[model samples]
Target: MIYLPLLISITEVIIVTVPVLLTVAFVTVAERKTMASMQRRLGPNIVGYYGLMQAFADALKLLLKEYVSPTQANLVLFFLGPVITLIFSLLGFSVIPYGPGLAIWDFDLGILYMLAVSSLSTYGILLAGWSANSKYAFLGSLRSTAQLISYELILSSAILLVVLLSGSLSLTVNTEAQKAIWYIVPLLPIFIIFFIGSIAETNRAPFDLAEAAVIFVFFFLAEYASIVLICILTSILFLAGYLLNFTFIVSFIKETEPYLYAILVDSKHETILSDPIIEGMVYGLTLGLKTCIMIFVFIWARASFPRIRYDQLMSFCWTILLPLVIAFIILLPCVLFSFEIISSNIHLL
Candidate 1:
């Protein structure tokens, strides 16, 4: 029985992880394509149909290359750093739902778990940079540590607002609360802040100082994995997770012309859509589309904006974003009280 449960858990992990791994591979291709389009240039087109297989080709090339370590570097920590980073980056996916009840581990404290896991990725980065024994790598790690720590405050604050509204720390509950309307509608400002914080947390442009000293392919893969995970998280927290409501359109069509509605919406449509397996597939697909859109935004921002100076990046976080986040933290409760819209589910801290 114990072995049975362990086997089931392993299966669940495989289901969630394989898709994420494939998506991370293609996200690199998408990044190239998006940047090329933005710059009005051609992207990779020779590897496969419109460069579809370019990511795999690149991965192969990376695998074939011999790793050359620095003479003075700590061999153990140097190798261990990227492994640690990749492990923690992948760990966040255990809590993130792809559809209803579709996760490796869906616990009540999932949000907290995600936050804690994400914070640990920085330690791997710090270790890798320090172990490299290169000044550039060490400096990059220091900047990343400072940046991640600073922006995490903003990220947590923004999530706290969502938690307040949803009255649960679980991402599953967070998604359910937005079934009628996404949190984005009411919390647009907070969503914007959250999105920015996510970008920074992922070490993406214009805050990509962390990648300046990349030493291993594992580091690269780990970063991309983090990007996809963060994008999915953004979609779940802001958009309703896989819950689309087209009832208004259907109702309007039915009211206008009953015959047309009967022709357009038939038993087959209902049967296919209502089937549990099909419903789960559709929900999973919807979530994938949402995640892809967020990933594109990350690429778009990278291509559109220049990397900010390290000092400017820190200043923006501490001086501007931190203060704004603090103000919202104080002001949100007051607004909630004034409107009597405070969630009954919120536990007093």
Candidate 2:
């Protein structure tokens, strides 16, 4: 019986990870295709079936590509940079509930865990830039440090709005609170702010100061990896993960029945199983669809926007995003209080 549950957990991880990895892989292809169409050119038509295999070909190329290191550079830190970034990026998946009760770990501090892990990716980027022993890499690292630090503040402030409204740090609870109306509707401003902040956080175009090569071909693989992580985190946070309906609740009940039965009896276990799995699946699908849509939007922004200058990027984060986020934080509580007062007076009417 214990083995069964363990197997299920492993299966869940594999199922979720495979699709997400495929999505990340194809997202690159889709971006190229979109950019090609925008420029009125055919993109990757020679590969296989509308260039669907191009991503695989690129992966093969990267795998075979020789990795050279500066002789004077610290080999340990240089190699550790990509490792750390990749690990941190994967860490976000721990707290992101993909379907009803589908997450590998569902800590109550899910939101905080996400923030902490996401922040670590920046350190990896900085380390890579400094250890490369090249001026371009060093400058790129400096730009990334400034950009991530400035935007993270705005992103955290926006996330705090959701935490405040939800009254819980658990991603599951956050999604539950959005059952009737997504926080996006009530907190549209914050949603927009978070969306843009995400773009900056991931160093996407219009905020991609870290990879401003003269030919625009300078690829920051570590930075791009971090961006994919941010995109997934965004979907998990605002888009509502697998708990779109009461599916998470139903799944929870089903999964915990053994422990409940061990304590109570067969009657209680049967009572829990009365909840239908079909309902849970429907809700889980709803949440999954929302997350996919959010991911698509991230891709859309990348396809549509142009990269901004480093100074302009800083100004946007500090002068624009910071002020707006601060305003929302200050105003949200007041608005909630006014709603309470108005509700009380309506009863007197």
RMSD of each: 2.2, 8.9
lDDT of each: 0.88, 0.71
Best by TM-score: 1
TM-score of 2: 0.79
RMSD of 2: 8.9
Which ten contiguous residues of candidate 2 have the minimum total lDDT? 213-222
lDDT of 1 by residue, 15-134 (tens): 878988998899999999989999999999999999999999999999999879999999999999999999999999999877789887888999999999999988998999999999
Clashing pairs in 1: none
In candidate 2, stretches whose alpha carbon ends up further than 4 angstroms from where it belongs are 1-15, 213-229, 243-284, 341-349
Question: What lDDT score goes with residue 60 in model 1?
Answer: 98
lDDT of 2 by residue, 83-188 (tens): 7776776667777765557578988989888888878877877887788787887888888888888888988899888877777778877776666666777888
